[model samples]
Every structure is written in structure tokens, then in C-alpha cells.
Target: MLTKDELCIQKEKPNIKDISLELYKEFSEEILFNQIFVYYFTNGTTMRIEFREWRIYHMLAIQHINGKIGKDRFFSAIENGLTLSDFTINDSIKNRYKIYKERITMFLCMYSALKEANVFYLPSGKVQNTKNAKADYIVFSEIGSKGMNIGLMKSGEVFVPMTILISKPSNKMVYLEDAIPMEVERLEIINIPIKEKEQDSEQ
Candidate 1:
């Protein structure tokens, strides 16, 4: 039986229609359970979709248990899992795991659908302020018989770019927000299945 928290998480799960029914059908819970990493491709350009670490979900459950029922009770609940019927501890663990799994599933589905669509780079990480920083790629937009340079800003730590920009001849900069409207593209599902050992290591 699903706990209240698990039910809530399921209710908020991403819609399969948003990505596409065909893509969603490509992946199964058994397949996604074995995946270690997933990449999203727009046109030909690629970016890694950050998967929520299992440690984060585990830590969230720990925090919830500690805050709600205290550390001693948390340990007690763990030791007495067979007999104790504490909903708080069970719900927290179940809820966090549900979120962790759903996010990975959504990304995989979206990537499969968008892999062949028009490429628009989505930069990741912090914005660098150094002149020496080089852009991974430059996109051009035509305006009034002139071509304008749009640079992809990359972070020093991560190779993937996250933001879009518009540069004009007059040195004016236009920053585009990361929110891609739902209507922009229909997404599909793709899976990168890994060995059981590798999946266990990730957890």
C-alpha cells in the first residue's frame, strides 16, 4: 500500500503526454532502475541532465525523521521496522525515493523525444566573468541584413553550457531565461541501462 506522501508524489509526477506516449513506452521501471547516467540532446548539441543522487534522497528522509520524531526514535523505527508502524519514517523514505525515481524517468523520456529537434544549447553551472573564458559554441541570428553573435556561457567546473544570450553590434546583451515553454517541443524517452553492480554503486 502507498503512503500518503508517496501518493502525493505520484499525483505530481510529470505527464507522459508532455514528452510523448511513444517515448514513454520505450522505458520501463525495470530499465530505468538500472540506468546510471542520462543525456539530453537537442538537435545535435548535447547536455547532461543532472540526476538526483540517492544520497540526497536518503539524507532528506533522515532529516525528516530527525525533525519529526527525533534521532533516537528514528533509530528505534529502523530497528523495529517489522513491528513498528510509524508512518512518518516510512512516508519520508518512500516520498523521497518516489521523487528521485520520477525525475530520472521524466528526463529520459524528454531526451528521447527532443534528441532530433532543433538544437538550442542549454548551459549549466555558474556564469563566468573572465575574458579568457571561451564559449563552446556560438549561435547567430540575422537582424536587418546583419548577423549578430550569440555566445553560450559555460562554467569553469562544468563543461556543459546552461544559458542563452543575444549579442548585438551595439554591444547590447539580451539574456534569455531557461524556462522553455511546454509548447516548444514534444519530448520522447530514451534509456541508458547499466549493470546491476554499477546501479548499486550509484546508490
Candidate 2:
């Protein structure tokens, strides 16, 4: 658990891949079984972002059955003082443990991919309509800064600031094209081996 004051202190930026892999290794079981898995990372700045995973596989299972991918998305909250309980969902999925493991694995993979691409380290600005009345750091697409004249932003050009909350609902993972609010037609896809055997074989 990270506090606001602790998050305000500047620290050296840890390798995103290392942090993600470590967190996955340490908390994989908690992520699969718990209602939510919460963690924090600092970008070598006075700001840190909160990452959360929620268990809502029954909804996802229905969406999967109906082929509805719209709700299968991540959420960005710019407000402060938000926590795991703030993002709530009913859980009643069949074979929830299995689905939870699958969804959490996919979610962590997508998260690591985005972090490697620096999607969460974008330009920072204040967001409106946030839960907290006070202004909070919000990360938006490059187009949001440069206007619509520039067309779609290519991969490696997108940005996100620290101090915001990014969350993934339990479901099939969607890439940045669907995750972020940008006119990105495609992003450079990175192949991340999620299984130990696959990693070992790749080595």
C-alpha cells in the first residue's frame, strides 16, 4: 500500500519490465483470488500511478459469449484518494478461479506492454469531471495536446503522466488502440512471453 505522501517523493525510475514481472511473480495468486490487486510505481518523479485489477469475470464471460468487446476495456481515473473499493463489481462467474487466472495473466501482459511503450508516461494535464474536486494529473493522447490536425498518433509517440489511476477489468485484454482516447489505427505490438516455459524456451 502506497500513501499520497510517499507517492510525492521523487525516486529513481525502476525498469518497467522488471517491476511488472516482479509484481506478477509476488502477487499472482493474490491477483487471481482477490477481488482486486493494487500496486504503485514511480516514474523517477514526484508522481506515481496506481494500477488495479478487478474481478468481474461473470460480466466478461457474458460479453465473451455475446462477442461484445466494447466493455472489455481499461479505465483511467485522474482523481486522487481513489482506492480498490472504489471500482466495484459483482462476481458470480462459473469456474471463476480459472477465468480469473486467465484474465489476470492477460491484463498484466497488456500492462507490461504499455509500460514498455511509455504509454503511461505521457504529458500531464488537469482533467475535468473527476470525482475529486481538486485538480489531478491526467494523461491523454498526443493528439489531445497537438490538436486534430496532426492525424493519428503512431506508436512510441503516445504519452501518459504519473499520479493517475489506471485499471483493468477482468476480461480479454485490449490494446492501446481501444484503451486510450486517440485516433491510433495501430500500435507496435510487442510479444511478451507470459509463461515460464515459453520464456525459458525463448532464452
C-alpha RMSD by candidate, in order = 13.8, 18.0
Q: Model 1 scores what on Cα lDDT?
A: 0.32
- In order, the Cα lDDT scores of the candidates are 0.32, 0.27
Stretches of candidate 1 exceeding 4 Å from the true structure: 2-31, 36-40, 49-203
Error of 1 at 120 (Å): 11
lDDT of 1 by residue, 84-186 (tens): 2232246765565454333322332222222333333325322234333244433333333322222333434222222223234453223223313122233
Off by over 4 Å in 2: 1-48, 52-94, 118-203
Error of 2 at 94 (Å): 4.7
lDDT of 2 by residue, 1-203 (tens): 32222212313222222232224323422322221112123332232232222222221122332222222231122122322222222353334423433333233332333333233221222223334312222222121112110011111322221122222333212122223332222233333334643454366
Distance from true position, residue 76, model 1, in Å?
Answer: 14
Q: 80 in model 1: Cα distance from truth in Å?
A: 7.5
Q: Can you give the lDDT of residue 101 in candidate 1?
A: 39
Instruction: Give TM per candidate.
Output: 0.28, 0.21
RMSD of 2: 18.0
